[model samples]
Target: MTEKQFTIVRELDAPRETVWRAWTDPAIAAQWWHPHGLVTPRDSVHVDLREGGSYAYTMVEEATGDSWPTGGTYLEVREPERLRFTWGNPGDAEGEAPVLTVELRELEGGRTEMIFHVLGIDEDRASEQSVFQGWTEAFEELDDALVAAR
Candidate 1:
């Protein structure tokens, strides 16, 4: 079976710079990195936005208080345009984890079109769908954060 690859595109009302800042800035990212109902503490968010740099964040479930830590190393970083990174748990070996590529395109009237491509997923369709759903929710939170930041 082939590894799964998926892409999610979102049209955000904010400009590319604002959306980029929300993604690359740790404090801003923590505000909406997780799905709905989960909270990522600002202090727990760390970002080194550059090639070969790394980022990590901890998200706590509101009801269960469970914490999940996610970390990744940057492969390519293009300011306000693109970012490619390896994503997985903090201890994951480099190259063993999945890769995420995000592209931001500035549209007319200050809107931004963002593409999130996830690669190297080895899972069933249902599992992939769940991942997609989670990201959808997270994107919703991201939109809210962008509005609030304005």
Candidate 2:
């Protein structure tokens, strides 16, 4: 089977460092780590931000109380610039998981351009409630978190 990938490039109204913290700091990540209608409680977030380290979080659907647990190991970590990691169920084999890379570029006026890429999943799995849509909504949540932080 051919592996597929998707990339989301966003211009965020925050600095690269801020964006990096938002991803690496569990406290900050818990604010926006989930898609719309889902909540990632701060207690459910764990981040060990370093090469070979791992991170995990659980997103809960408020209405149904359904929880989705996700985690991954860091393949590469370059603070405020780039991060590459596996993304899948906690404790899953890294080799079998999809890889996600996030590149952050500092833009003019204290803003950032973030390039997010995910590899391994096919298009059919990238449906409305899946990877693509989930991240799209999560990013929107991140934007709100950023604004509130300012």
Candidate 3:
């Protein structure tokens, strides 16, 4: 049997533009994209908010002093609406870069629904589980950071 794809969604009470900005801007990403207590030094993150573009960033856990690098290329980008990227850790034993799709839908009363999908990990259930758990916490942290930053 192979691993299965996963989808995660969160309703953020922030405007679409605000949430979009947080994802596309490196400065803002440095502050929020990473998990809480994970420090990504300023000027080390790169983001290109266009189709076919690429980005690379690092995440450092402050307490354990662990550092991990993440990089991926954009497969789709629609401002304030959707983003698709190929995501992978690059050095894992499984060596797969699952496709990550983020769809943002704007709702009335200035809210956005952020839906994230992880695909292409059909042969490694353990990896899928780990990624799912990590992303779950990461999204919650992102929501917290977005609220505070906005």
lDDT of 1: 0.89
Candidate 2 C-alpha lDDT tens digits along 1-150:
656988899999998999998999888899999999999999999988889998999999999999989999999999889999999888777788999999999999999999999998654444787788888899999999888766
lDDT of 2: 0.91
Model 2 regions more than 4 Å off: 123-126
**All models: lDDT?**
0.89, 0.91, 0.78
Clash pairs (backbone) in predicted model 3: 3-122
Ranking under TM-score, best-scoring first?
2, 1, 3
Candidate 3, residue 1: Cα displacement in angstroms equals 7.1
List, residue by residue over 1-150, the lDDT tens digit for candidate 1. Answer: 667888889899999999999999887898899988789999999998889999999989999999989989999999989999998798988868989999999999999999999998633346534767777888999998999878
How many angstroms is residue 35 displaced in model 1 relative to the true structure, after the best TM-score fit? 0.4
Consecutive 10-residue window with the lowest summed lDDT within model 1: 121-130
Give a tens-digit lDDT track for model 3, residues 11-128. 9989988888878888778776565567776677888778889888888999998998887888999888889888766464333677889888999999999988888743333653
Mark the regions of model 3 whose C-alpha exceeds 4 Å error after superposition: 1-3, 90-95, 122-129
Ranking by lDDT: 2, 1, 3
Q: Model 3 Cα displacement at 74 (Å)? A: 0.4
Worst 10 residues of 3 by lDDT: 121-130
Clashes of each: 0, 0, 1
